[model samples]
Target chain A: MTEEGKQAVAKARAILENYKGKKLRIMEVCGTHTHAIFKAGLRQLMPENVELISGPGCPVCVTPADFIDEAVWLATEKNAVITTFGDLVRVPGSEMSLAGARSEGADIVPVYTPIDAVEYAKTHPDREVVFLSVGFETTTPSACLAVQRAEKAGLKNFSILTANKTMDEAYRALKDSVDAYIYPGHVCAIVGTRLTEELTGEGISGVVAGFTPSELVTAAATLVELCSKSDEPFFRNCYPRVVTRDGSTAAKKLVEKYMEPADAVWRGLGIIPKSGMVLRDEYAAFDARKKFSVPSFKAKNPPGCRCGEILQGKCKPTDCPLFGKTCTPEHPVGACMVSQEGTCAAYYQYGGVV
Target chain B: MCVGLPAKVVSIKDGMALVDASGAKREVSAELLDELDPGDYVMVHAGIAIAKITDDDASEAASVMGEL
Candidate 1:
């Protein structure tokens, strides 16, 4: 094993050995950690007393299907070019995905950064370029910057279909709902430890952890220990090198400058008030809602898809009847099985089964 | 969703810094900090350097961690 892996394993073993035979339930909020746990075989090594669960950390999983349909609709427009992160293209919509639409003569392009979307519009000034902006705090600043750049360049053809949400709201929504939270290291790096203070006040214990087998085990063990001690919410940094008391101020500034808090709809969680960010009026020229006149479409969850329950921390991937049988990664019925950082995809990729 | 990390500023040019994180290198904005430079660890989120991390504090915490 690598040195980091060995250290993580040692720490995890120490945590497990110390908490063996104790009753505890811990939930890791990051889908990446969920994948790491199974990938490292930590679940097999963990004591029976400690139960680890998955939370709503996957951005693609939480995105409602209506948003996917809207993107697909935009892709089908005569002169409209749809660009998005690779993960969104294959996520199954109620009727079809963008990939499926592309097969039927829709113009769809996958780009890594949001800036690439702006560049596409700049290159093809006559074409309507829509950047499908989706992510949490980590990617929000970039999407905001893209909007600013579009406005600066006077690229009226450049706009974004934003589905950006903040991490604190999701954490707060899950506080009373879960036993303990294994907070996402990446998300925490943006929001920082201050958000944990509020989570603790609501009686949730949180530990920001990295996405490695050993790091996941350490987080699980810390959670068990914290749960064994008190009902008060605790904020412990297992990923202290990456996360701090205060998060990224510059990213926060960019986000604040270009976007404002707005209500967003999650596939399972319904409409969360002030959980999403929309482009400010100053950058309204880059807003997709204004650029395209998309008709309102009803959001629909796939039949027999328990992604909603899985997202709410009420059920595991195995609890879903279609987990491995009908809803494998190859033929996913929901977004959870589509994205790499999604809970279902994590479970399917690793050795998790229903 | 958001995937941010901590990086150290290695050099600064035109309101941007050549930042390194555990062997990963990328250009980041140095507009937020007052006097950041080489060997300084700063919290990096979404490709931007947000704050200066004190070496003393990090070392003290690392030492405590090593003891653990």
Candidate 2:
């Protein structure tokens, strides 16, 4: 670390240690942030009055169980191969996870990127390929690009099952739950700081944060210092190196060309109006939900699993009766336990820290 | 799956860039970014280069704190 970096860390810690404000509840709105916070031991550095909470930032964690049921149905009944990021394979559906279905002869393939799924479909012309498109803005463009590539290649067997969500609405829904937020850096890298800056107009305060120790601490310091000055809201792009004020216009235009906002259900937060993205009508042929006619199952979190409450910042992972015992990562009962970025997974990985 | 990998672009062809994150190398879609060169550093997520990383986080953090 440079001298300036060391000074920044020392100064941030000093400010935090000298904090004399009221009890503050700050939520990190990305699952990756939750993991990074735990990995960096940021919580240990906080004063007793400040608390760090997890928000609905993990895309797979927020994805409703019904979406997984649709994927399982495509794999089992429709005889379509399910291609997805590995996290979604373990997330339980209404009946079973993709992994569970795979055990019972469902063909499930985990790909690192949506483009890889396109390649898989290109190679297997006889088989129907459905990529489980579950992410926020960060991964949504890749899904769009995949659909465009499939269209250009004339690959009739390729489609995507979208559970893609946007962060703007989720932040609005949870505005009253915390004093400020540690925004997901990558999401801002796509959508830019305009939305977050506009959020301050509505009295929502936050800082766009990166995934490094110095970046995380600096964001916390900024929040503490700003919030202490007054009750007014503020926004800062702490991770300016990656997130620009405009973000990526090309990516934004691509998403606009392929997908549109739709009312989507979150596992915990329910359906926030226009919180999710779906392929436009013209691209229905590339949409697995329409192409396969897979029915949406009425779904709910498993009994006694407090993942919903945990996701909303109403409670912590340890507050759930099944968190460490029944909902172990090896055999997760809820989506929160399955994804590495999930809050429950991070808490468990960090020895159930509060 | 939402994790972003900061990688150095080694080569580009037909809207695809071969990136090296740490020691691992792979071809990721570069169609999103308008201008990218072989030596540019970018944040790659889900096999797509999302944004160009300007500097290391240490320096970024220093500048952020300097403003704070």
Per TM-score, the best of the predicted structures is: 2
- Cα error of candidate 2 at position B12, Å: 1.5
Q: Please list the residue runs of candidate 1 whose C-alpha ends up more than 4 Å from where it truly belongs after superposition.
A: A1-11, A352-354, B2-12, B16-68
Model 2 CA lDDT for position A88: 82
Q: Residue by residue across A116-205, what tens digits does model 2's lDDT show?
A: 999999999999999999899999999999999999999999999999999999899998989999999999999999999999999999
Q: At residue A25, what lDDT does model 1 achieve?
A: 66
After the best TM-score superposition of candidate 2, give how far the Cα of residue A103 lies from its true spot, in angstroms. Answer: 1.6
Which candidate tops lDDT? Answer: 2
Clashing pairs in 2: none
Docking class of 2: medium
Q: Estimate each model's TM-score.
A: 0.87, 0.97
lDDT of each residue in A279-343, candidate 1, tens digit only:
88777777787667777778677788888778877887788998889998889887678787788
